[model samples]
Every structure is written in structure tokens, then in C-alpha cells.
Target: MSDYLVRALAFEGSVRAFAVRTTDTVGEAQRRHGTWPTASAALGRSMTAAVMIGAMLKGEDKLTVKVEGNGPIGPMIIDSNAKGEVRGYVTNPQTHFDLNELGKLDVRRAVGTEGALTIVKDLGLRDFFTGQVPIVSGEIAEDFTYYFAASEQVPSSVGLGVLVNPDNTILAAGGFIIQLMPGTDDETITIIEEHLSKMEPVSKMIERGLTPEELLFEILGKENVQLLDTMPVGFECNCSKDRFGSAIISLGESEIRDMIAEDGGAEAHCHFCMEKYNYSVEELESFIDEINS
Candidate 1:
């Protein structure tokens, strides 16, 4: 099935929730990056959360999530916008290890228990917001929970999971974010806390073919959740040959010429989607003309 996300309010608007199913979305990323089981889990988990967070933005605004953990997987960078578009990459996509004590992917080992999770929001009009928090757990979900509380000052529960098949492909990937808005009553908080503690992992929910709305219903109760809207989500990269050529042009005519001299062409690789853009000698000369003109 296709990937999509839902935004809803519950507890009479005192609580905000977002849920999404990202199986195909993450599957594509795994195929593109050839991520190992553990790395796939880390990247997929981050992407799932990042896309849900992206739903919090308005038009034209976007955010970047950076996970700089002190582990073999290195740093992970993900970008998402209000449009339900997200793309990401880990510095070491092939990183993997035996299952942890829980028999799940050793995400903490691959992600490390140190470093920081930083978010930079581009709100347009030159308005930007930056938040940073120490990585509480390399598990991705806990780190985001800590980030929301410590950096954004919002008490939130972030559940993220990515189940990889034996072939290193994604089995199921999804997550949910429940945020307690200001003025939340104690009773509501307690109820949500209880539900989250007893509920199954979000990945299992997705694996069972639960929709985003159903996932939210399980978390917040069908009666309390007020369905807002849903948007399709997927792996999308905006990189193009023209875009990379322009970047090379910014390096000045001398740099562009050096590429033509040293190599027959210039190749630019996108870390997000692993897409490569090639600029032939003819294309390089054209860029030089554009720079000179």
C-alpha cells in the first residue's frame, strides 16, 4: 500500500497526535541506500518521525533533522516539508550488527548513546528556528521525545519503528507522535501515558495493515480523536543535474574549468537518495558561459 500520514487532535484538542504508515516509503530508501538491517532501522525510524514532524509546518516551510551519534553509523541527515515529502541518508548505510538484548535491531549500538539531535526549521521570510538536544537514546524515538521536551519544551511521546526483512528490505515502518498541549488536564495525561505503555510497537501496527487513523484510534481512543486531514507521504529528492551544475558554478569558473581538465566530466552524488548527476564536458562549458554572462 502507499504511504500516508494523518494529523489529528484528541482529548478535546488538549492533545495533538500524528501517525503515518511508511512501508513503501522506507522500502524505497533501503533499496536506494542498500542499508543494512540496523542502518535501515535507524534511517527508517528517523525518516518516519521526521515526516510526521514535517506535517507540523505550513506551506513552503521545511525542517531538517540531524542525528549526530557517536557510533559506527555516523551522522544521519533528513529533510522534510509540509508537503509530506522527505528524504534522508545515514553516513554509513551499510552499518549493521547482531540484534541487541531485546532481539531487535541493534539501533542503539549502530546509533550510539551519545551525540545530539538538532533541528533547523526554515520558516521562510528569513525566519528560522533551531533546536538541539543531547541524544537521550540512539533508538531514534527516545531521542526525539527528549528533543521535543528539552528543545521545544513540549511533552511528547514518540514511537518509531522499522522492521527489516531478512533480505535487508523494509518489512514495515511507521510511527506516531502524541503531544500534550498546554493546559492538558492530569487525567488526560495519565490516560495517554497508560495507553502508550501497554500498546504494541508502532511497527507491528503497520505490519498488521493498520491505517494511520486506526493507529491514532488505538492510541487516543476513537471517540476522543478528531480526524483532521491526511496527506500522502513518500521518498522524494529535489536534486537535479541543473541544481548540481549551479552549485558547481558557484565554485567559480576556475573550479568548473578544473573539473573539465582533470576529468572528462563532473559527477555529483546526492547523499539523500543516492542519485548521481553527471555533467558532461559540454554541460560544464555551458555553465561557464552562464557564469561569465
Candidate 2:
């Protein structure tokens, strides 16, 4: 099935929740970046959480998530919009290590134990909303859970997981975010906590082929979850030759002339999707002419 996200209200609207399946989306990322097992897990987990966060926004709104830990993987950057389009990359795509004590992909070791999780939101306004917090846990889920509570002052539980195949491709990738509104009663909170404590890992659930709705029902119970909406999700990059050309044009005529003279061509590389755009000498001259015109 195609990747999609489901938004739901539970406990009579006192709690908000989101769940998404990102297996195909993350597989695309692995193929694009050639991430190793550990790096795939780290990047996939971040993208899963970021996409859910993006669902909280409205039209034209978007957010960028940065995981700058002091690990071998360097850092990860993920961008997502309300439209369910997400793209991301890691500074070191080939980083990997042996499994941790739990026999899991050593994400904490790959992501380091120090640094910050930063999120910048574009609300289509004059000022952007930026929230940052220290990495309480190198594991992406716990870090985001802490981010929501400490940075946004919203009590939340974030469950994210990514399983990598033996061939360094994505096996399953998905997550869920549950938030408690101000008036959520203690009983409801206790019940949700109990459910979470007993539920399977998010990655395992996805590997078991659970749909987003079934995933929520597994966590929140069928009677308690009220599905609000669903939207398709995938790895989508906004980069293009024209977009890169516009950037080169903005560099002004002098820079364009230098590119034509020194290299006879220019290339722009997108970090998110690893796609490169080449500008030949003639293309550079046209940009110069466009700038002059």
C-alpha cells in the first residue's frame, strides 16, 4: 500500500494523535542517499517524526527539523510540509555500527549523546517559529518527545522506528505522535500511558503490515480513536534545474561570468535529494543576460 498518514482525535477530542507509514518513502531515501543500516535508521526515524509534525500545520506551512548530534553520522536535516511531502539527508550517509545491547540498530551511538534538536516552522508569516532543545535521548523518538514537552510546552509521546534490511535498505519505517490537550484528565492519561507501555515497537508494527488506522487502534483502542483525516505521504524533493538556475541568477552577473570563464560550466547540488543540476557555459550566459535584462 502507498504511504499515508492519519490524524485522529481520541478520548472525545481531549487528545490529538498522528500515525504514518513511511516504508516506501524511506526506501526511496535509502536508494537516493545510499545510507548504511545505522544511518538509514537514524534518518528514517527523523523523517517519520517530522512528517507527523508537518501534519499539524495548515496550507503553505512547513517545518525543518535538524538533528545535530555529536556522533559519527554528523547531522540530519528533514523538511516536510502540510501536504505530506518530506525530504531529508544525513551528513554521513554510510555511517554504521554494530547493534546495541538490545540487538537493535545502534542509533544512539550513531547519533551521539550530546547536541540539540532544532525545529523551525514557516507559518507563511513575517516571523518564523523556532523551537530548540537539547538531545535528551539520542534515540529520535525520545528526543522529539522531549522537544514537544520542553520546547513547545506540549505534553507528548513520540514513537518512531525504522528497520533496515541486511542489504542496507529500509524494511519498515513509521511512527506515531500522541499529545494531551490542556484539560485531559488523569484517568485518560494513565490509560494512554498504559497502552503505550505495552504496545509493540513502531517499526515492528509497520513490519507486520499494520495500516495507519490499525496502528492507532492498536495503541489507542478502536473505540477511543476517531479518525479525522488521511493524506498520502512520500519522499518528495522540491529541487529542480529551474530553481537552481534562479539561485544562480540571484548571484548577479559577475558571479555568472566567473563561472563561465573559470569552469566553462557550473553545477549545483541539492543536499536533500542528492540531485545535481549542471549549468553549461551557454546557460550561464543566458543567466547573465537575464540578470542584465
Record all residue pairs in model 1 with backbone atoms less than 3 Å apart, i.e. clashing: none
* Per-residue lDDT value at 202 in model 2: 91
lDDT of 2 by residue, 230-290 (tens): 9999999999999999999999999888898899999999999999999899999999888
Question: What digit string (tens of lDDT, one per residue) describes model 1 on residues 18-100?
Answer: 99999999999999999999999999999999999999999999999999999999999999999999999999999999988
Model 2 CA deviation exceeding 4 Å by range:
none
Return the lDDT, model 1, position 28: 93
- As a whole number from 0 to 100, the lDDT of residue 89 in candidate 1 is 93
In terms of lDDT, model 2 sits at 0.95
Model 1 misplacement above 4 A: none
On a 0 to 100 scale, what is the lDDT of residue 84 in model 2?
100
State the weakest 10-residue window (summed lDDT) of model 1.
Answer: 121-130
Tell me the TM-score of each prediction against the true structure.
0.98, 0.98
